[model samples]
Target: MASELPLPLLALLFLVILPPLCSSWRPADDDDASVSRSVFPMDGDVAWVVQVSDLHISAYSPERSADLELLGTALRAIRPHLLLVTGDITDAKNQQRTTSRQDEYEWVTYKKTIDAIVGRGGIDKSRIFDIRGNHDMYGVPYRGGKLDFFSTFSVNSQLKRLSTITSILLQGDRSYQFLGIDDTMSVGIRFPANLFGHPTDKRIEAVNSELQYLTNHSNAPVTKVVFGHFPMSFTASSEKGQRYESVFTRQSISAYLCGHLHAKVSKQLWRYHEMRTTEGHKSSFWEWELGDWKDSRLMRILAIDGGAVSFIDHTLNQALQTSILITYPTDSRSMNMLESEKWSMRNDINVLVFSHQVIRSVSARVFDSYSGFKVVEEIPLQLVFSSSADRPLFHAKWNAENYRSPSPTRYWLQVFVLDSHGVKISSEQRPFSVEGKMAIPTRSWLSYLVFEVQWEDMYRVLMWSNMAFTILLLFTPKILYHFVSRSSSYQRWVMSVLTSPIQQRKSYLWLVWFLMEGTRSKPFWSCLVIYVLWLIEMPWFWGRATSEDGEIAQMYLSGWSMPFHDGGLTGNKLSNPDVLVITLPFLYLVVIPVIVLIYGLFAEKAIVCSRRSRRVEYSAGSANTLAESARLLPDAPRALLMKFSGKMVSMVIQFWGSWTRRALLLACSITAAIHLKLCSKLMSAYGMVPVALSPPLTWMPLLLLGAAAYCTKLHGD
Candidate 1:
């Protein structure tokens, strides 16, 4: 049955969806009303730098037209000396076309956009520098007609040459270096070359050469700035999962600017900062991933005068300033006083709160909600010590009695610190879940027996079933053929012969059939058994495998971990199996035809042997026997049985091949699922999965269902 939605609810949904569009519709006003502009006073020769990426321009259209117009107007007014347009300048659709008509219409449009900005007079041509992106390799083809676009443009003499992935640019007396890297879109941290048809080593070497060039040529001290299409760092993901820093540290790079990620809102900017101190230099890398020009596009203005660089964010008519603040710990105190030094049931946890401002009187309270507005007991504390530091760190401890309440439930500790004037300085809160320990269970020899029995029993049952099916597939045809080949008289005679001791002793026919069946099933079953054992022994096999310290094992197992690890598997590890899967399927198909040829040869041999035996018998005056043999030799039933048997054998072989392939695939999927499950469990066990952030484990069953679907697809195909 269909249900209708209420009008009010439908209207509410529509209203909720309309605000984003309405906000986007209104263009940015030429004012600093929403932001503080006074903080950034422009006095020096500093101009805002706006990095544009993945423009993907084409001959004037709705999206590109608007983007070009807005960017052109904004750039003309700002006039930043160092404007870096990073990658994807042109969208190359087809690679097989001729050079002149090589479908660079997008690049042509991009050029026109640039021309519109700096004008046909070429006044601003020197200010705009372009780095090669992935799409630039469309002209050159590699193996199987795949294009190596980055190399093509990178080496192109008409285009600018920096380093392979890093280049240095010197502006006036102040030097600024730019490092342009290949894409880092992969599961590992190191930059991969296949995405751009270049080797990571070669790309890195190119960057190194550029650094060498800068070192040899430049005489003045330089503030290095790296430029790339991909962000060097990312959050909510692993560090070894992407290239977070420059490959080399020869140059003193201050900031890294990238443009792959588009900004959604005007005021929001993603800023990641890291500090590094070494023998020669102490520096910080500020990664500024510029927003897409189409949406929330803002330029960065850097003013350098008297050996100092100040970064400012600006639109066409307004600008904003940013600053860095640090906080640290001051002193430690307890909320509730305890009689003894150590509590019997629980341990006390000290809360250290670091803030940017000065703090005075502090209060510790037990709270109902996470915010701690409704306090259970407000414990006051005097300031034992104070410090004037960029990062002011403070501490408070929670005693066991403070958490002991009549409610018999989980509670949270909230600590608030105020300044001398009683204004709220800093606050910190943490939730604690309470649970009672249970008695440990006793273990005996029966437990070990039960565990072993379950696995062994299952293994034996599956193995026996597999062997039985294999034997039935092999010998059922031979038995039927033997019965059908003999006439009624011959059958009776054979039965009489079988009763004779000498004849029964010479009956090696059954032994031959047994050998043939064994030959067919043994190899297949052995392989299957080995694979099953491997599946069962997965944990032990992986437990002994070692990777670099702090390196995620799943990444290495899945063939996506960094090559920098001491014992990590590399790209070659993945390529070998991928090649085998692609090439072996055809080899298996060829083997089927060879098997058919062998079967035909055996059938011909049997025919020849029977004819030779009958000829000898006829020559020896056994004419009656020969005539009877001839009459019975047509073997209509045996021929039909043989045909049926061949068909069944073929079907069994096909099914076995399909099932084996499917089993391999299923094993892979199961391994992945187990890895993911273990990772989830580890996160939960370590309390890294926050209570507020963690979702229910309800999706686990769905994942299992999806794995089943994948297995079905593997077998069905």
Candidate 2:
């Protein structure tokens, strides 16, 4: 059967297709320059660079139209000498089936977008370069039937295809050169495979080959630049592989630029960036992990004038800007100081000094503040160098004059190096001491005691309780099943007890009515008097006194001597104890009292049911003797015995469940406690003690209370 498409669906598709076509046909403007501007000076020979990545573009849609307009406007305004579209220009293509109409449309739209970009006259088409990002190679094949999709769009011969592994050389007349490499995304490699199909070793070889080829072919000194879509090093992959360093070493590349990581630029980006740059060649290397255009939408502009490169970063929304300048030093040197040099007391302390021209030809001063007094007197120092160029690596030796005997306390050595440029780089304070006296102990015993107490009292209790509770909750049903299977009589008893109230409802109602009459006969004032008397007598048999205060006092006193005099039993009386003793006894006593009260209220109802049954049995006139009545009465006892058995079985199952629950709960509580205790200890050891109050210990108590309440509710139901 053939299905016909709905007209409304077709209309909807038509509406979606109309806007893009209209946008594409709209006349192109060559002079629009309102969007972005170059920061480089007008007369200077500048290198205008544009970076684009993660395009994810498909066909000419409304989204693509807006993007194209912005990009076109920027190109006209900046009039960049070169543009680099780093990677991920399109989504992955489906390779298993024949190319579909959608794929063809997407490919055409992609070509159109590129054409529009290149068509802008401000950017030199020859200088435009594209690097294969992960998405560019989609639909390519791998080992074991896996498809490498990024390679599909990346290798198209119709467009000016660029290699995934490549470099460019910038020189006069021959302003730009492009080197292309393969895609790193392929099979039989490690998890974080190379962007190019080749392994890192092979890639390095290729890069070296390309660099050597360019160096040999160029007529002038070429400014070398390399581009990729991933940063050489970052937090996530800092320890993963060696591709970053390997590629770096293979070529004397000026700057390595990449963009996979969307690192937040504000917090510690500068420090990490500075650390990654080569030490002596710091100005020669630069990296930029361009942020996403949709969210952060940041871009970088690199302007080169002769040997100087200036980088400016900007947000897509024009909300923020930052700039940095890079220049190679015309002359530089290295210096090393001998640590074995010793100071002498005979020479005036002022005679010791070191100097360097690059470090700015300024006098040096050294001071040793070992105690309250200055150990070394003021010293004047001079620098001697073989030549001006050699001054950068000059070193000086200093011997402290009139240096007295070592002080018994630790001291700090402060060195101040001042330059003619007014730049002062200070070394971290160095600590030294004269033959040592005992050092003052910074840790206190009280802190240790508190930590130990918390671990034992709070942490252990909570961990154990949690473990016990979890186990009990998991195995409760099985325990119940086992109890029920043990005795048929118990099962019968439970069924009878559950059904008894339903069978004798009418009798229960009459008995309740009789009790109301009896209560009504009593005077209200007399009844109140009797209640007061009962309350006055209840405490004598039910109440128990708590001694927690005495136990607490005892615990506090046992570890240290007290100012007040303490005597045998008096000391015990002053200590605190657990309050559970008094509370538990009172709770147990109240249970019996409640049971007695209930029995009294229901006694009349039971008697009425019995009399009714006896009358009916007599009317039947078969075996109506006392022996039969006795036999019938025994049935009640037998039923009760079966019910008792059922209850016993239930209690046994409940006990196991409850014990397991308590054990689990206790274990979890202990684990949590230990974690907290360790944290506190670590914090204290590092001198992070609170200046005010301490952490509250109420959580454990609250947890236990909640668990008890939950268990009580479950058991009662």
Candidate 3:
């Protein structure tokens, strides 16, 4: 097999298998690439900006509870110098083309949320800046909302078409030159942004003119930063692109910060050709994009120390503290105190742990600011007291004596434990810093892995067995059928119940197979019982052009909701599949054929009685006999009603017995069940969902199988 090889096949294998194996891949994490600025008091960094974007605040949106509280909490916790909101201020819910007026509810909710967050005084009105997003425009209905977002926030003074907010404080020593740019077209929302954008030549000229003025005046040493609502890449056409680099690169602008993509931390250098530049093209400008606050629940503290700019990533998920509290050394107090005191290395640090799990192991690791962060310490934390009386108080006193780094340091604790579910969980790693001469603390890493899995756990075993049992139950009827066919008594019972040819020419219709005397089940009691069950489901049947609802099956059905709708019979109703099983046996096996049989039986009896006790029979078939003998009955009124009822039933069976019609019913049921199954994207690992069929299609297989057997049972096919 190996000797006979095709060259094309061998080449195809090479083409398919080598690229991913050879290429380097990096695992994505939440914080590794994040960028933030810090206001370190020790380093004399006086100011930092916190950016939040895309607050799609709907007026009638459901409360997110704890998530809603994160914005204010994270902001207050961060204690940044200012907050910058780039775009997307409102949610513009249900906007329409005819709706000219903006929804005021969104603004009201936005104001309330912002006020609640910034009103507590750590942050205030003056420290916040905002710009209008496409949602703020009310010109085009769903695509746009209102143009008063900036005015509402009261940051209009900072709106410089090509001007700058000068002399803004930065690292206590350096002045910050903050420039603002508007790069949005409201009426079309992001439509124009996808192609050629609003013209940028005038803005570029104005910006360059100001830069010349500053250079001519020999203005104080400053750091130039620009903020905008959109990115250059958003506009694909060159003729309409914002040629920021042409002006910014000429003026030597360091960074361009924008927030429209709601992107996570990614650092990319944009290289572009400068118009009429003596220095040609260079990719020196750095673009920093921020994530959204409303959906992402993200905020950052940007700290710039001399030439080193660091971004600290923060998110709502990272802050979820479920009883895993470091009580003694509070997040705010402990780290700040350590940095303020400027401790190099100390072993006197203590931490308490009482996570919602049984402690399997606990330890602490320290990061050194000196020795390139290699000088480290690890200490096996001892459980001081663990009794049923109190929540097990485990303590870790990291011995930092081994770490002789001559700089400030940071430390974090790692606790591995088994939760009530016997699953291992690791506590969130918190970086506690001690600012010093040489502290190079890396970001804390927090995660855990389960070392073993118990295969025979009760929940796991019970769930698997349940799935096995359900699969077994589906085959039970067939299994019983095979065994019952072997028993003589069972065979006799079946023979007695099964319909037989009583008349000379028996109805060859497969529809009459599950009845007695070619009409109904043997022993009138069985026929009456089965017929009533069928009648119970009769009102659900529909004779409509639109196939949305029906007696047994609906054209359009979803989930566990619809199959049959007969509110009169049952307070709620039976599902289409349930109704199908209940009504089908009676429809073909007993109901329709039985009605025709009884009509003939009574008509023959009436004809004979009317003819002076002489027997009369028609050779044409029962259809003509039914019409002829209907008049000979003694009770004329009762006979008329029965004739009408039988006629109605015959008309239904005419369509009902056709394979095409019933197959369609079965098709609808199967389609609905399949749609429900395919619609679910995930099978949750925690809970087991049985492979049970849903409405409209659940019993399609059984019904169709019976119909198939019925149709092919005769040799005529």
Candidate 4:
């Protein structure tokens, strides 16, 4: 059983420790180091790019057809200045989705879709940029090889290399640079193994080179943006001290756009990573992740209006007629303020509204959020004549002097539009500050900022947490046994505080304690031994890898290998921290706990049954003695028999009296069931490879637990 620790103390410890875990590692101060001059000088006030990710186009699935048609239609309707397809251009799985492989047909389908769109004049081929997702690289032994369908069929491959760099020079001398980083593993192992983004040192150095944009003049500011398949958290650090985050920060990238997490998290995907550079200059960049285009039908329109970045995530559907994005005065929540803040002098509210049909009218509304979001004023916006009729840019003149504020007061802005066909749509209310000060983020923004996981910290946390938990499991029981058995006053007082009153009541203490005693069993000890061995000498998983010679099955071990050791067996094996950090924790934390609970359930039941059987045997023996006494004294025979019968009946009733133990058994069963269900969901969500793979981490726990449960019943009292 689990020894008692104060819940509040544990909670307090967690609260104290976790803040530093989340906050401490980033390098820069909140106020980024000021650049001597502007970095984003646009020919015009507005430049927008469309981003769509995780298409997962499949040849066998009927759903992909709809997605393809939608993509073509969207391209024609939106006609964005640039289109960035972040990754997962193909779903490399069979019809059952049970196995993963790089199917050429899926790539062919994706390629044909893009080719059709371009042929029909949907969008220019030069503007369309695509990159590789984990799914795209499934079973790819090497880049641009026979198995490399992406390099053969993808849009970027036809026009450029695996990674791309594009420079758009506008009407004036101003320009924008778009750098796409391809960090997918060079080896491109099978799925479940090929999860993290692995960028080589050469690739990272090349990225830095691409970012070093210099024009004829030294002061020329080219707005810089980077796009990649993986978020910084999912990306592994490169060899030779190269880091994607450091490069981006040092280069003063405007923003990093990515898409891999589909629609699992919405606003929570946004994060601003701040850190101080090696030069002691404060720097930071925003990581904006978009949802998938597969299931969510999602796409983002990212705009830079006078160097201030703003975006809107739009959902695609048949009835959806229009999309609206307010470019300037930019949303006050925009954090890229180091380069420009022209809102103070701007006299117009600029909005980009795209529609397939003729627009009837457009209007803007302002609300004072500090005054309980009461509507302050409404103004009609006039469509700019110079703007294209299809992608109409709407604006309305407003007096900036009236709304200027020295303090951080907040207001909400929303745009409403009605098309010629009577379809009405409105944009989500955006919180803004008129004085160019950062507005107080509303509930949605706060949730995103606070809850989004910082991936950079995640690798270390997962590795260390698994290590801590394993150490505890291996030693906690032995330590408790030593202290628990002792009869010192301190020990007694500690035991009373931990278990006495709480143990008497039906509480979660039962769940904890149930595993404590159960840890002595072979099933528990076996897992602990395996975990320790895996942490040190054993390989956690056996997966396939490719070399120039041929394909071979490779063993992957646990523990960290971030910079990757050179020229040894350790370097040759797949000991990536990214894979180990995830898989090791799952084995130790989730699978092992369920095993312990199930083992305890049957062990506890056998003990109770044994005690009941002993009491029955004792009662039977007393009844036989009473019968003998009654036979010897014939006069009181009946009375003696009646007394014996009553005593035996009472003993039987008393045997079943421990309802508290029954409750514990019931609680544990439910907990195990819930954990198993969660395991099932995860397995189904990620697919069957690693979840239900060989060496049997998932099913083996259940099997060993079942064996322990069965063996307990066979052992007699």
Best by TM-score: 4
lDDT per residue for candidate 2 within 52-77, as digits (tens), equals 65565554333642365456555555
The TM-score, computed over Cα atoms with residue i paired to residue i, of candidate 3 is 0.37
Q: Flag regions of model 3 displaced more than 4 Å.
A: 1-46, 62-69, 95-101, 138-150, 153-171, 186-199, 210-219, 236-242, 263-277, 280-283, 317-717
Candidate 3 weakest ten by summed lDDT: 447-456
Q: Report how far residue 101 has shifted in candidate 3, in Å.
A: 8.1
RMSD of each: 24.7, 30.1, 23.2, 8.4
Give a tens-digit lDDT track for model 3, residues 562-674.
Answer: 23223211112112121222233323343333333332332222222322211122222544666566666667765676667656654553443344334534544454444
By lDDT, the candidates rank as 4, 3, 1, 2
lDDT of 3: 0.39
Local lDDT at 1 for model 3: 24
* Model 4 segments more than 4 A misplaced: 1-45, 164-173, 215-218, 239-243, 278-282, 334-344, 357-391, 394-397, 406-409, 414-429, 440-451, 459-464, 479-531, 541-552, 555-591, 594-717
Flag the better candidate by TM-score, 1 or 2: 2
Q: How well is each residue in 239-283 modelled by candidate 1, as lDDT tens digits?
A: 122123443443435556666445542233334233443564433
Q: What TM-score fits each model?
A: 0.35, 0.36, 0.37, 0.73
